[model samples]
Target: MSYKTIVVHLDTSARAQARLHLAIEIAKRHGAFLQGVFAVFAPNPRSFVVMAGTAEYYEEHETVRHEEHGALERLFEAELSRAHVDGEWIDETGNADDELPKYARRADLLIIGQDDPADPESFVADHFPENMVMSAGRPVLVVPYAGSFAHIGRRVMVAWDGSREATRAVHDALPLLKQSEQTTVVTISAAHGNVPGARPPGADIAATLTRHGVKVTTLDLPAAKDVATGEMLLARIDDIGADLVVMGGYGHTRWQELILGGVTRTMLSSMTVPVLMSH
Candidate 1:
């Protein structure tokens, strides 16, 4: 279970290079093809009405957009050449949240940057990472907005909850987990009721991974009062000194708005290490 193709989202953000470096490392590790995808956000024609001349203003906006696209392409090519990794570049014109998921379908894994609340304009699209995780049918690895990750998958922490999403995340991360020197499966005992085949939360999964030649350990944690489950998981990651985390992305849609589960939202907002998530 090795990644054959790795796709990464690139933009004008300063952290784009960090994300690309991480993606290149993963691609080189697994001998995978790397793809750099850049989404050019075109100006909306409706906004031209605010200007004195609608058509002329729209044309100028498009011209600037094209220039930016060309510059980004050059940057991507230079990086790829410097790394000397087998790769390709994809330039799309649209909202990143919509187009990235489409590109993700062809890759084994999708790499994206976590949104930085300090600079809302850092992302090319609104809710970019979150939307991709919800829409992409493949595993999405989100790199933190702040930090340089020189190594990944050396120590792994899996947040298991005995749910379908959690199971999918575990399976999707098998290649990485199998290669890790240490893998810990942490399950929070929060009194989930009457679920069939829910034998000791993380034991079964740990056994299954051990059968697959993974150096695995199981740790059961009790939820503390007045603390969110996601916070507990984050604390555990720090305690174990894990460089990577694998977990399920839980969310629901209400009135056309996608509302993420508390754990998923919290992790995305405050993650210090890279996280691999599947929905």
Candidate 2:
């Protein structure tokens, strides 16, 4: 449950530096190895609109992608040298959604930049959190578009659903939770969904964590009035003054490479704190 290795998905977007800074900060704080991964989307031949005059321009633009990969490696190496942190750099060619998770499989935690919708080339445009959560089946620490995080586990909030995704997130977050100065398991539902005969049915989920030596609090939020679970979770996260929020990635497949998932899109749109998600 100790986080000694972290994989951060790097990209060539404007947000790249912010993401890099946060990852390095976390690695230093935890004494963890930083695995820097830059994902390149296989240029879509079909998506290119054939243009006679622009043919050369398009080819030149594409060439830059390759060179940019190399430049990123050099940049990260320089930065890591200054920080005195050992890290490996990788430039993987494929759909970031597919390739990033494969490399993330062995990491204690995965870090990704929260993409800006304004940027057409944002890697997060692929709805990666959904795929990463499902495929990587690990805790993902997502840095929001702006503020960076320091030591994440000092105080935390857990959004509990008792679903497999939520369960996986809890297990994946055990390392952080165990280190937290305080951890709260908050379950919001119009009605209780605990399994029958589960002890501390006041959402015994919180009690289970208490048994693990976590300074824990469980709140069965009855005001679960909102059908929008994402909003509820965010509101509660604010209430707790927690810097980190841990929850399951919730999604229902909308189409191939598309998910109209509730909480998935909600957090993507706006989140108040850093979120650690698992599918």
Best model number under TM-score: 1
Tens digit per residue, CA lDDT, model 2, 105-224: 888889986766776545543666556766775678887776656557788998877778778888888877887899988876454465433543335767677777788887766545
Per-prediction TM-score to the true structure, in the order listed: 0.88, 0.83
How many collisions per candidate? 0, 0
| Predicted candidate 1 versus true structure: per-residue lDDT over 21-113, tens digit per residue | 889888878888899998644557887777788879678756765675677678777867776778899876677878788889988999999
| Candidate 1 runs further than 4 Å off | 45-72, 191-200
- Model 2, position 74, has a per-residue lDDT of 86
The residue pairs that clash in candidate 2, if any, are none
The CA lDDT at 46 in model 1 is 83
